[model samples]
Target: MVWAWLRIAVAVVGFSGVVAGFIVNVDRARREGQDLGLVLANYFSLFTIVSTIILIVTFVIAGLWSLRNPGRSPEPRGIALAIAGITGPILLLGIVYNALLRGLPSEIALTDPSGIHSLDVWATESLHVIIPLYLLVDLFFASRRRALSWWSLAVIVAYPLLWLTYTLIRGGLTPDPSGAHDWWYPYPFLDPHGGGGWPSVLIYVAVMLVVLVAIGAGIVAVGRLRSRRAAARTSPVGAAG
Candidate 1:
């Protein structure tokens, strides 16, 4: 019951933040005479935004299941795997943003000295920090989860791998709407034409892939441990054994 409500709350907050940030961004771009179509395209292209939306959807589904089932565990094998898979990328979003992108000048004109700028700041924090941390907390402390197989790591890595491929291909074909560079990438580290060229971009991508897989492995291990503990608690020979 409590967990169901918590999941619902998280979904609500995430939905609100993503929508508000997008509106603020569109408005800012329009005010500055930028093309709205290009702005919307670039906005949705961000990994952070996509990952956050995935998280939001997962929680909404989980929450609704819990509410419907009441006392039963809402996370079956598939749902548990989905949660485990997304954990890595979502946490990576927070790690990358805070470590590399926090202080950088945003393309969204986040610093505008206007009334709605505060909303943008809050929205940014929700997407990059608040929701990520909440997911981490839920991953560790949620009462129920199913053990995942070793091969599930591949499933976990697939979304991010596809996202990277799409980002690079689209970036090559698209021009920067802001005219800041010939190509526009959501993050500078992934920009092939930057100072370190393709080599630098490859290095960054490799490092991030390694980190993401590591996070996934950790989640799988934790899920297995938790599943074992839950089983023991319900067995005839309990924790005393």
Candidate 2:
């Protein structure tokens, strides 16, 4: 559908922007002339930690609300759970790992010339990998409403995808030696020269797209199947009663 394709494209662009923006700003902090390292570090810390915390609370509320109301609101419930379940955990993991694995004291974050820092890699991938999966589930559930179409699905998927793409490109396009060294698992797809070249990253993207779409289709099938079973269960029993 036209809407579905548009939604998918939007997600791709959004993903790229968020990552890329964060990376460029991080580099700007490290550059000798820009030595806004102290200022930017403080700002980044302020925004990143605070925003992540806020998002966790946001998803939790959404999850709680969805669970309280079922049946007629099944589509909304699935969508809420997708984001709350995935993003919420990723945020929690980042907070735990950043504070625990990195040995940062309470109320502190460490950022230095090592590009950004290891904690960032953990947080970034944790968020990225999970989001696509969430979008996949949302598309499936949303498509069932008669008024909606496949295009609606695509539009929804595209939002986060695009935001993340922006962020990733902003980070490493110039090919920083230090950045490459600091890069972590699962996200080497963003490495300069595409690492094994653009082909590698493109393959990764293709795979992600397929997995996301498949997961959505599966969700849609399951929801429909369950609905049918519920209807059957209710109908005959109503006659008997």
Find the candidate with the highest TM-score and give its number: 1
lDDT of 1 by residue, 69-161 (tens): 776453777778778777889888889999998988764555465678777788889888888888888878886667888888997899999
How does residue 14 of candidate 1 score in lDDT? 83
Candidate 2 structure quality by residue, lDDT tens digits, 79-183: 433442333233333443454344434111233455555445544443444433444444344332222233344533453466346545544432232343332
> What is each predicted model's overall lDDT from 0 to 1?
0.83, 0.43
Residue 56, model 2, lDDT: 45
What TM-score against the true fold does each predicted structure earn?
A: 0.94, 0.43
Question: Against the hidden true structure, what lDDT does model 1 obtain?
Answer: 0.83
Measured with C-alpha atoms, the lDDT of residue 153 in candidate 2 is 43
